[model samples]
Target chain A: MNPTACILVIGNEILSGRTQDVNVQYIARRLAELGITLAEVRIIPDRRPVIVDTIVAARAAFDHVFTTGGIGPTHDDITAPCVAEAFGLPWVIHPETFRLLEAHFPQGEFNAARQRMATLPQGAVPIPNPVSSAPGFSIGNVHVLAGVPRIMRAMFEELAPSLRHGTPVASQSWHALGLYEGALAAGLTDIQERFPGLDIGSYPFRRPDGRGGVTLVSKGLDPAQVRAAADAVQALIAQLGCTPIEGEPPP
Target chain B: MNPTACILVIGNEILSGRTQDVNVQYIARRLAELGITLAEVRIIPDRRPVIVDTIVAARAAFDHVFTTGGIGPTHDDITAPCVAEAFGLPWVIHPETFRLLEAHFPQGEFNAARQRMATLPQGAVPIPNPVSSAPGFSIGNVHVLAGVPRIMRAMFEELAPSLRHGTPVASQSWHALGLYEGALAAGLTDIQERFPGLDIGSYPFRRPDGRGGVTLVSKGLDPAQVRAAADAVQALIAQLGCTPIEGEPPP
Candidate 1:
């Protein structure tokens, strides 16, 4: 199995419903592509105490923890220092980060506002920022990145190569019309019991044509296990006398 | 202040980057408008244990807790029962909710999957779902709502008329152009200490012309206190020879 990971999304804008949290989905998809299991996610505000507590907890709980938001120069951006304090490290300006910031501006005539971006917690490694000069950093198992999805994505792309891969993820899903979740509940449970390593999920859908069905999803590191579980689901649907659709249409 | 609240966003799709968490931001903005202090937000997966633990923790910690997602009829939607387990309530069909469901699909002939939507924990009050027949419920201070933003928003709208409103929210803000965070640190700290009741926040802005500035925000129930603190901030900015923008523009 791939190692477990957790995501901590920090922003009052997200909690207050002003801005939707797009970065969590981006991170999950990326981690899946990299064969990592996203086990948990927590959305928190930019408050220093809460951020510090959650980050510390996630660090101890998960193999890898990724935090998004509050890394900017804004007053709401407290992730950097809060993270530093969590690990009992002093917040200091990193020389290399300053170099990157200096390159962005000419004559190295650094504005103090711009210099704020170079500040890092003591003993942290800078995560390259391809889109913006304001780089993210990593301390221990925690990867703190920008909340902006575009910049965060670019940073992840740069960082992915160096990270260790555990197991490659694979999934197979089947869907059909005129099927109820409860009717297939017994069979699905049986299939899950048979394929212990596979994670099976049932999602019901309502089509525009007023038809409804449940989509059976089987996911695991072993392609054979997922395929076997999916095949069993199809066979169970056939036994239930429903016209079994081979698989859900690709998104 | 009209009692504080926290929103917990639950879904794996959100963390996996497949879905965006729009509910948290919406709830926060609404609470702010209603003079309710939105303190924190936590997003977790569909996992039962995590859901139960989060609900339990939030209930003990916050005045009112709002949860979004995992209340649908699908198999993965286990939020309702998990909440029941968290609070030690028996999982039973709520009569009012059943009546609402029956009104929509009178004969239970709609589909077994549709009937699945009516299952509620015993002793839960139907929050009323205007958009859909699946009723959200409230047990104690925890308001469990749907994941769909449209339905959740509507449900809250229906529940709002009955909720108790306290003091109106008051806020004052001043924008300082191209002022570094460190340079204004002492002054901001003094302002915060001078106004104990006001929730002072500093928000930095990246100007379109490539300049940086911080907007200091203070929120409180006392209009006089808010005004005095805001005036002090405005005066401090003027003393520093930093131009303070007049009035709050479109955020």
Candidate 2:
């Protein structure tokens, strides 16, 4: 069984549509490589109550939970304290974090606002940021991360080694132009039913020039089963008078 | 108060890292323009129980609930039936949708698999799809749309005017190069406190060349308050000895 994970994007920017979020897709891909099932992804506001409640719920529900945004120096950056409140722990200044931050900043420049970055939940473990000096942290199952894509990527790559590994899911696909999903659905169902373990999917897409295509995918932990299902789908598409093109359609 | 909305993206492709989803951003911007607050966004897999439960919960929690994906002919496309189960209504074929889809296909091509596209929850109002004839539907507050970005955009635009409009939220931003967040955090907090109605945000970004900057935004329904907050942010940036650039930083 794959260890399930959830990503909580605690940013008003994304929810407001002011920002295009690339963090979720980046983390989702990383988790797949690590064999952790990306079960859920949420983009939520920086509201304290929402963050606290979601953190508590997500931690209890999934094997791992990652949160991006709200760990900055600004007032909206309330995630660290909210996480502490959720865990029923003291929001304290870690000596090492405080010292590292204090030393990094120029003399007398690390004001009370910058010091907020040093304060974390009592039991939190700092996830180092190579892009910026400010560190994200983890408390139990929830990993706090930066909202910026570059910083978030650095933090996750640093913290990823600590997460539990599961069986890696492999995928095989066959796609073809002029292949309607309705025409392929029946044969696809038969393939799925025959190999119950593999998840067979039919995705229809229309190209820019008004050409339509369908991509048939077989995905599972077992590579052999996925490959076999892909073969069946390829044959099925050929039977429908469309030439099967292996792999995903071009962007 | 603006009407609140939650967008549910139900797709294994998104979770599996096989696809990057643009549907959420597109819907979120539209909802904002319609004076609706996009409070939350969830990306869940193509699972029956999860879809039904999420639909029930989201519809009850938000004023409008929009779902994308899994309304296709494939076996994994269980959204339509699950929506019916959530509302405690029977899933039945809609006569108008059936007629349109049947006519769209050639003779005998409207098989059982293709006919599934015509199925809808009891009392569903079909939302016309200009890109593809297979119509999406709105049952209660939950509007079920397609996963495909092009089709979803067409469907949402057709159905957008029917949504209840609140005070449209507008935004004003001030950004500048080499402006660090810690330097702006204090004054930004004061600005936020002064204009409690406006949502003040401070976002830091690092360019590919390693040049860092900050974008400060003030958003709210009141144009005067939003503008005042933006002005204050501009002044705050100047106070830190940096020239303030009006509007958001360039991508």
Candidate 3:
């Protein structure tokens, strides 16, 4: 079985509709490439109890738990101390992180607020930040990352190599123009039953010209099974009187 | 206190990194406008047990629970039946939904798979789908919506009037170029303490001209409190030697 992971997005901006999260998609895709199954994503607010509770729950459930946001220098940035509390560890300042931040800032520019970035959970290891000086940390299986897209991507890339991986999933898609999903649902269900190991999904898309179509995707750990299912889906689309197109159709 | 809501996004495509969700942000913004506090968002797969468990938990936790995706005609579309099971109601064909689908499809074109769209929990009220013939149902406080962006928006707008609301949140923002978030964190923290009713957040941005800046936003139910916090934030920026702009900087 593949190792599973969950993402905890800790930010009030997301819940408030003030910001759209790109971190979940980025981490999901990256974890997929690393052969880890991205199981769940929870977008919660910056509240202390909620964050701590979510972290504990996710840590117990998944092999790896990644949290983004609330790691900045501001007051709302409470992820570090809260995560420490979740693991029953003391929130302390890391020496290496403090040195890195001190070197990055100008003379006397690093104040008490800026120094908060250096504080992490006891026994936590730093996740380097290429975009800025503030570093994220990892305690146990939870890897904390910044909410900013660029910084999150950089931190994830740097930390991904250390994570354990499983068999990478392979996927293939077949699209047919002018094909309604409802019309093809029965056939798709039959195909899904035939290949129980594979996951089959049908999505409908509308074109700018007012034409709509359906796209059938099959994914699995076995490449051959995925290919066979894709071929069957394509044949099914052809049987429905529509030409099958490889990949997604343009809008 | 504002009435709270939660969004449950049910789809494998989102967890698999094949699709980026826009529904959560849309729902959050709309709920905020309706004076509903969107407390949490959970993105989970189309699994039966997971969906049922999440639905039950969310219904118990929030005043309103909105779910998007898995209400389609395909086999992966299992949300309706799962939701029915969650409420301990037998899944039955909603008569009105069947009538609507029958009228929408041509004679003899509505297949068994299409008929599945009419299925809903017993005693559930149908939420009209203006974009598609298949209707989403509402049982108790849980309002199920479509996965497609356009259809989801239409369904939400139609149902918004019936939902209980609180005082609408008011917000104001101040942007300043050459202002680092770390530098202004102390002052922002002070302002946040002073305006206990407001939610103050600091976000950093990279401008097109390669300049970095921060945008401080204050949100609250009281307009005067929001405005007061916003003014304080602007003054803090000016005191730090950066002129504050009233809104978002041009990308």
Candidate 4:
């Protein structure tokens, strides 16, 4: 089984629709490439108790838990301390983190608020931030990173090598124009049952010009099974009187 | 208190990063306009037990629950039955939904799979889908919509009038160039304490030209409080030796 991961997006900006989340998709794609199954994603607020509860619950459920946002210098940046409380560990300022931030800022510029970023859960290792000096941290199975897309990507790239990988999933897609999903569903169900190990999905789309179609996708760890399922789906589409296209049809 | 809502995005495509979700932001913005607070969002896979569990938990936690996806004709479309199980109600085909689908599809095209879209939990009312004839259902406070962005938006717009609204939230924003969030954090904290009713957020951004800045946003139901907090934030930015700009800075 692939090592499973869950993402906790922590922020009020996202919940309020003030900010569109770019981190979930970035993390999900990267995890897929690393052969990790991205199981779930939760967009939560900056509430401490809720953060702690989600962290504890996610850690217990998945092999890896990634949290983004609330690790900055502001008063609302409470992720590090909350994470410490969740694990029942002491919130301590890491000497190395302090030194890095100290060097990054000019003399007499590092204030109390800046120093807050240096503090992290006990025994947590710093996740480097190439974009900004303020680093994220990883403790146990939880990796806490920045909410900003650029900084989050940098931190993830730095820490990704340390995560354990499983078998990378392979996927194939077949599309058919003028094919209603209702016509394809029964055959698709039969194909899915025949290849229990593979996951088959039927997505329907209607173009602006009023042309509509269905796209069938097959995904699995076994490349051969995915390919076989894709072939079957293509045949099914042809049998339904629609020519099967190799990739997604233009919307 | 504002009416609170939670969005449940049920799809393996989202978890696998094959599709970027456009529904959450749309729902969030629409709900905000309707004076409803979007509290949280969860993206889960096409699993039966997980879907049912999340539905039950979310229903118990919030005033409204909006679920997107898994209401199609395919085998993976199990949300209706799972929602029925969650409510301990019998899953049955709604006659109106069946009539609509039957009328929409061409003669002899309304197969068994097409009829599946008519199924709903007992005591549920159908939410019309203008984009697609396959109607979504609202059982109790849970409004089950489509995963497709166009269809989802249409369903939401139709249902928005029926939902109860609260006081619409008001917001103000101040931006400062070349201002580090660390330098402003302490003052922001003081302002936050003084204006406890307003939610203040500090977001930092780096421009493509390498200049960085911070944007402070104040949000609340009270417009006067939001404006007052924004003024204080601007003053704090000026005190830090940076000119505060209203609204977002040019990228």
Using TM-score, give the best candidate's number: 3
Tens digit of per-residue lDDT, candidate 4, span A178-242: 98788889999999999999899888877888888988999989999999999999899899888
Clashing pairs in 4: none
The DockQ scores of all candidates, in the order shown, are 0.40, 0.80, 0.86, 0.78
Looking at candidate 3 chain A, the ten consecutive residues that score lowest on lDDT are A242-251
3 or 4, greater by DockQ = 3
TM values, all candidates? 0.81, 0.97, 0.98, 0.97
Q: Write the candidate numbers in order of decreasing TM-score.
A: 3, 2, 4, 1
**lDDT, ranked from best to worst:** 4, 3, 2, 1
What ranking of all candidate models by DockQ puts the best one first? Answer: 3, 2, 4, 1
- What is the per-residue lDDT of model 2 for residues A105-180, given as tens digits with 9 covering 90 to 100? 9998999999999999997999998877899999999899999888999999999899998988888888878977
Answer with 1 or 2, whichever has the higher DockQ. Answer: 2
Model 1 chain A, poorest ten-residue lDDT window? A12-21
Model 1 residue B242 distance off true place after TM-score fit, in angstroms: 13
lDDT of 1 by residue, B104-212 (tens): 7646454555565677777888888876668888888889888878888998887766665556667777888877555566677678788877766665557567676
For model 3, the local distance difference test gives 0.91
Residue-by-residue lDDT tens digits, candidate 1, A125-186: 99999876789988888888988777888888877786766776777777867876756776
List ranges where model 2 is wrong by over 4 Å. A249-251, B249-251
Q: Provide the lowest-lDDT 10-residue window in model 4 chain B.
A: B242-251
How high is each candidate's interface RMSD, in Å? 4.1, 1.0, 0.7, 1.0
